[model samples]
Each structure stands twice: as C-alpha cells, then as structure tokens.
Target: MKRLASVVALAVVVLFGTMAARALRIATPAATTGTAIAIPAIDTAAAALHLAAAVRFPTVSLASGGPIDTAAFLGLHQYLQAAFPRVHAALTREVVAGLSLVYTWKGSDSTLAPVVLMGHVDVVPIPEPNLRDWEHAPFSGDTAGGYVWGRGAIDDKSTVIAVLEAVEGLLRAGHTPKRTIYLTFGHDEEVGGRYGARVSSTSSWREGSSRHSSSTKGGSWGHA
Candidate 1:
C-alpha cells in the first residue's frame, strides 16, 4: 500500500510539472511595434522644488474630526497658483466644500465625455512621541540625500503636483485635449472623503459628465 501511494503522488507531481511547463511555453509576451514617441523634457529641479514647498504645509487631518488648518490649505492653493500660471489661465477652477478644489479643462470636442483625475492634500497627523524618530521634520519639506522628506511627499500630494506639472507643460506647448479633463483635489481624505471627494463628485455629476476614469490618493485607478 505504501509503495502504491508513493507512485501515485510521484505521478501527480510529474503531471502538474508538465502542465506548468506547457503553460509557461504558451504564455510568451506579445511583440512590441518598436515605435517610440518623443516626449517633452520636464524641469525636474523646479518640480522637486514645488513638491518640497507643498510638503511644508502641515495640512494634518485627525481621526477625532477636529477643526481643519485653514491657513495651511490656503497657502498651498496660493503657491499652486503662482507655480502654474498657465494652468490657472486655461482652466476654470472652483473651490468645493470650502477646502477641496476642482479645475476643469474644457476640450475642443464637446461630444466626448470628460475624464477625472483626483488626489488628496491632507495627511495623517504625526504623533509627538514618534516625531523624534524621524530623520527630517515632518513639515520641513526637506530635500536632502536625493529625496524629498515630508508628510505629504509620497501620498496624494505627489500625484497632485505631477498632474498639475504635466498639464502646465502641455498648456505651455499649446496642446489641447480632445476630451474634457477634471482635476479634483480633496482636502479631508485622511479622515473620510465626506466633505471633499463626495462633494466634488457630486459637482462633477451635476456637470452632466457620465464617463469617469480616475486615479485616487494611493495610486488606485477606477472607471465610473
């Protein structure tokens, strides 16, 4: 009985191994066309500076649902306006729920549905005990050792800055989109998106845009 069981187990393992090998052989990657499009160069130094500056704002959101730091968010808004003047001039911007922002870049084709891109500006508060353990000040926006160190540097702030930079660059190049684009920046995402994302979404819906594709705070992409 032992010998028969061993033989059966060996046969099962061999069968699975053969199946896996066959699957691997048939799972070859598709060939690429090898066509390369020329992308415009971006000013990395300036972008880094902008990101660092944005990180300086202590727009901390608490789980306790405390009062917001209005000054910080307002300061960030002013800085963005100064940094991307072209974007401000080309797109129509609206403040939602007193803190969140929505910018609409109307396209040439009215028939095409709009696209939405989202990010959050708020970050979780750093505990006082853990503050001493940080290599750099959480709100200092330190650019040292080839890295931007701060609270909102990686989360949603980077996404906001990146999208704005791309749009600003495109606007400078005089490139217009065929489909309308919406840029939504939520303020209270860390606590909950109630006053920020939810309101902005409703605003977008009111505009009659049915097709929605978005990239949210933690690099989550979805279609609605």
Candidate 2:
C-alpha cells in the first residue's frame, strides 16, 4: 500500500510538470526576422568639430543647487542654432524652465505615437583639488588623437550633438519620418532633473502625448 501511494504522488507531479512545460512553450514568442536598414554616409570630421566646440561650454551644475550659469546655457543654445540651421528651421523649439530645450519634429502620421530622445547639457563641477590630475582642461573641448575630450563630452553633450547632426543630415537628404520625434535636452541634470526633465514631461502629459519609445544618453560606447 505504501509503495502504491508513493507511485501515485510521483505520477501527479509528472503530470503537472508536463502540463507546465507545454504551457511555457505556448507562451513563448516566435523570433521574427528583421529588415536591414541602409547606413547613411556622414561627414565624420565636421561632426567631431561640432562635438569639440560643444565641450568648450562650461555648463556646470552643482549638487548644492547653486545659482545657474545663464550665459553658458544661452551660449550653447546659440551655438546649436548656428551649427544646425536646418534643424532650427524644420523643428519647433521651446525653452523650458528658462534653460532646458524641447524640440519637436512633426511627422506626417498623427496616428503613430511619438519618440523621445533625451540628453543633458550640464556637467558636474570638477573639484579644485582634482585639477592637477587632468591630462586636459575639463572645459577646454580639446580634440586630440582623434578623440574629443572634456567634461560632458561622454556624459551627455555627445548625445545632444549626435542627435542634432543626424537630424540635420536627414533634413539635407529630404527624409521625413512617419512618427514625430522630440529632442529633450535638460540643463540641470547633474544635480537632479527636477527643474529640467520633470517640467518637460509634465508639459507632454498635459498635452496628452504618449511616447512609443524613449532613448537617453550616458550609456556605454564602442571605442577603437
């Protein structure tokens, strides 16, 4: 009788396990083939120059919530407008919280959800004591050995410039996207996104705009 009871328990466990495996198989999604996209040709030297120039702006954000650098932020904005004329002419730009920038490139299809690309302009302040350890000045925006070096270059300024560059190139190529795109550049992200990203997000929410995809800066990059 004991042997029979053990066999019954084992049979019940196997039955449930088989059912769970079949359910898992049904829940798994099938892999689909993706279409390959043609890569566009870009002027690498011009892009590098733009990035180097961007690094020169000393848009520093302190953790203590200090007074904002109005000149630095404004200068950077002016530079961008000058650098990418096509983008300025094609997209609607708004200055949020007096510093953060929100640019909208309207699409043809209103039914499709919009896309948001985020990056910050402000960089953390370098400590006075750590000044001696630098190979290059933090705000020098130096381009040496085929690399753009400076604060904010990798953290976020790169993304900002890269997006603008792509947009400008696309505009030059007469390519209009089907889905709308938003380029959000926050000014006070190093401290916190309170006055920058939050305000922009709130405005979008109020306008009943839902994003289909969002991408941010400050991630790993491949190097040669």
Candidate 3:
C-alpha cells in the first residue's frame, strides 16, 4: 500500500509540472502596435555636401581638456550660414555659451511648447598613431567610395546637417509649424555636455518653459 501511495504522489507531481509548462508556452505576448509617421523628403546631394563641409572642420574635443579648435568651429558656423541661407534668414539664431548654436523657428501658436532638435558638432581627436589606418585623411571630408569619411561624419555632423537641410527645405516651402522648433548644436559633447547643452537647458527652464520633445541626430526622439 505504501508503494502504491508513493507511485500516486509521483504521478500527480508530473501532471502538474507538465500543465504549468504548457500554460507558459502558450501565453500571449503584449501588444506592440502603434501609428506610423510620415517624414518629409530632403535634398540628398545638397545635404551630403553640407555634411562633408561640416566634417572638414576639426572641432575636436580633447580628452585631456586642452584648448578647443575655436577657429574651426567659427568656420563651421560660417559654412552653415552659407549652406542654409533660408534657415539663417528665417530662424532666430543665437550663439549660446559662445560656442553652441541655437536656432528658433517661431511657430504660429505661442501657447504650445517648443520642440528641440539636438546634435553635437564636436568630435573625438584622431591620434597620429592611427592616421595611417584611415583610408583617407580624417578631416578631409572626403565623399569618396560612396561614403562620407571624417571624424564627425556619423558621430554628429551628419545629424546637424540633416536637421539644417530639413529646416531649410521647410523654410523654402514656406511651411510653418504650430509649435516652435529649436535647433541646438552642442560644441563640447565629446568631453561633456556641460558648457553647451546643459547651459541651454538651464536657461530655457529659467524662462518658465521646457521642451515638449527632443529629437537627437542619431535618430532618437523622446518626450520631455
């Protein structure tokens, strides 16, 4: 009788374990459906050229906290003004912290919060030892081999140029948004965003308004 009782207990345990495993295996996943947004088209060749021009500037942020390339940064700013004439003319451009660039495109409605688009123009310095490893000069802004080769090509300049191109195109088309748009190009993001992005955020917050949303150049957007 004791042997029979032991056999029954083992059978019950097996049955419950199998039932639990089967239940877990058949469980449904959470829903992930969402709406899709349609982004407007931009000028590919012109945007590429602008990005290439941006890359030529060696706005390198030294890790050891050395002097920044102020001349190159000013040159890049001049280039941006030349490339996006409509944006510079239409938007309210301001140089925050003497290095960062901020452009505000005033919208039709003042009640709505402004949207901020951010990107870094600063890039890591290329060491002399790794210079030979590069197929082309790191600061050449070479658009050869069907790719933009430079230090800030992908790290940030591409994004800043893309945003400028989009805004410039919109300005050309005379499209005005309901909410204001803010373009922030930080100059010292490689070391830390302290002097550039931090100052902008603090200043804006002091004005009793914050960003509604933020879109970074690396294709990330989030609500504030």
Best by TM-score, which number?
A: 1
Between which residue pairs do clashes occur in model 2? none
> Judged by lDDT against the true structure, how good is candidate 1?
0.85
**Which 10 consecutive residues of model 3 have the lowest summed lDDT?**
199-208
Candidate 2 lDDT over residue span 7-46, tens digit each? 9999999999999999887864566564444456779899
Question: For candidate 1, lDDT tens digit of each residue in 124-179?
Answer: 99989999999999999999998999999998799999999999988887878877
Query: In candidate 3, which residue ranges exceed 4 Å CA deviation?
Result: 1-41, 63-65, 201-210, 215-217
Tally clashing residue pairs in candidate 2. Answer: 0
Give the TM-score ranking, best first: 1, 2, 3
Task: List all candidate RMSDs to the true structure.
Answer: 6.2, 9.3, 9.6
Off by over 4 Å in 1: 1-38, 201-206
Candidate 2 Cα lDDT to native: 0.82
Clashing pairs in 1: none
> For each candidate, what is the lDDT?
0.85, 0.82, 0.81
